[model samples]
Target: MPAIISHDTGTDAAESLVYTSQPPVYTYTTSLISYALPPSQFVTPETPQVAVGAFIFTPPGTSPPKVLLLRRAATDSYPNLWEVPGGGADPEDTTLLDAVAREALEESGLVAATIVEFLGTVEFGTSRGNWCIKYNFLVDVEEGEVTTNPAEHSDGRWFDLEEVRTLAVTTELMRESLVKAFERVEELRRSRGISDPVS
Candidate 1:
């Protein structure tokens, strides 16, 4: 089993991993969305590999908001398994959050507009025996058609909570992350007065 660690910025419950370091905030804005970097740990030379994931939901006011999930290409590591749009952070990425926005756009053709919150981090061992720490966040994206990169992902769709529970997610950690994202969305809706029928 791959080692796992999480830190949910939306809650007060402490977990095995707690990120207190606040890096400089960076912002990226599109016509529809404004992406901002939240307080998070920086990637250092000691870390072998780091990845970033974006959990984006359907626009507000939808009966039951759905989160986007991508189907990995048959030739990819977890072929045909569904996962969020993300990948390894590139050296040119100014910050971990920048990687999140870049990967989301590259994989799903969605521009990350606003980074809602930092969901947490997931640590797992790669197939090559290297360890990778992936940081995930709840993001809002500009209105656009979902088009996945054929080489990396075969398909992409928005799935409701029930559908997500039944799908073949890439990893158990990923499923948990998706579930938490749903819960967070619900909270946001209630707080913002966006009416959503209970599911």
Candidate 2:
């Protein structure tokens, strides 16, 4: 039997994986949907690989702090796997910020009002290739309201860090890294003498 993945926020393991719409066969000129490399191109040992992923957060009358999560659309390679909002970096993207901004707009339809800080980078393997260096960031949304494109995501939700940790759709490494990111955010806030409304 094949491995089943859901990418769903909730725990409902399916017989197949869910993913975003198919990545184009050719890289697009448009920054939003572009690929790291054209499907026909191969990355040689000399070729460097850098990708970006984001942990977008919103403060919604906090009971628990919530971050945006995207459900992977079904696909042959990575059928159903829940992941942070991100994708391959474009050749034209000179900085990680360029890639992060483009991906957030394409995937979540929310623009980063302010780039709070760089969380940290992580190396993760995917079915698509051997390994990728993921650039992670914490973004403040220009407007919290989301306008997601249905073709890319089945559903979108704001999950508290604890709730995210409980989801089976994601990996343990991701949960731990994000929880740490949240802790750092709280620390930064406190150092500035800003208080969490709940406390």
Candidate 3:
């Protein structure tokens, strides 16, 4: 597991560090409190489904970088809300990376060209008395047009980072995770010398 740090305020040599394939690593404290997940209402009923989300970003150049977001269909669980490409794990998936790859492709029709960064997992309790661990990752996608499944999402588009924070989110769970993902993505942008007009 990678160490999760709050940010890079500790390093003045951050520029050199960011050029590498991996981001700066830091450690975090964990609680010893014993907690068990109730029967899940999602992928399974006995354990939290190990899900994954892919935060796809365009390269930093000619234009400001953009991240993809998809709007859920009005009939889906979190209807008419924006989120990155992701979904629950299935029986066919052998590992978390496979699940992430499959989910990203299924949800947004984008294939992973390379795994850029691991944004860590966010654990949250579900209304059904169960908890879920969502593993988020940043990846470069293969060149292709994004095609959203009409049954899954109403529409899909790439949005600027600033605009993403202001949109209506489907769940408080994802809203918090999204914020953290944005921070990591921004850090990546800065490391690559991408100019940000937001600040």
**What TM-score does candidate 1 get on C-alpha atoms?**
0.78
Model 1, span 1-199: residue lDDT tens: 2211111233332322221212212232231122223313444555568888888888767868788999999998889999999888877665566777778888988766555577788888887787788878776676778999889899999899989988999999999889888888887777667766536
Output the lDDT of residue 163, model 1.
Answer: 91
Residue 136 error, candidate 2, Å = 0.5
Predictions in order: lDDT: 0.71, 0.57, 0.61
Clashing pairs in 3: none
- Runs in model 1 deviating more than 4 A are 1-41, 44-47, 197-199
Q: Estimate the overall C-alpha local distance difference test score of candidate 2.
A: 0.57
TM-scores for all candidates: the values are: 0.78, 0.68, 0.70
Candidate 2 structure quality by residue, lDDT tens digits, 145-196: 5555666666677777667767645567777767876676666555555444
lDDT of 3 at 174: 71
Instruction: Judge candidate 3 against the unseen true structure and give its global Cα lDDT, from 0 to 1.
Output: 0.61
Candidate 2 wrong stretches, greater than 4 Å: 1-47, 193-199
Task: Go through the candidates in order and give the C-alpha RMSD of each one to the true structure.
Answer: 9.8, 13.5, 9.1
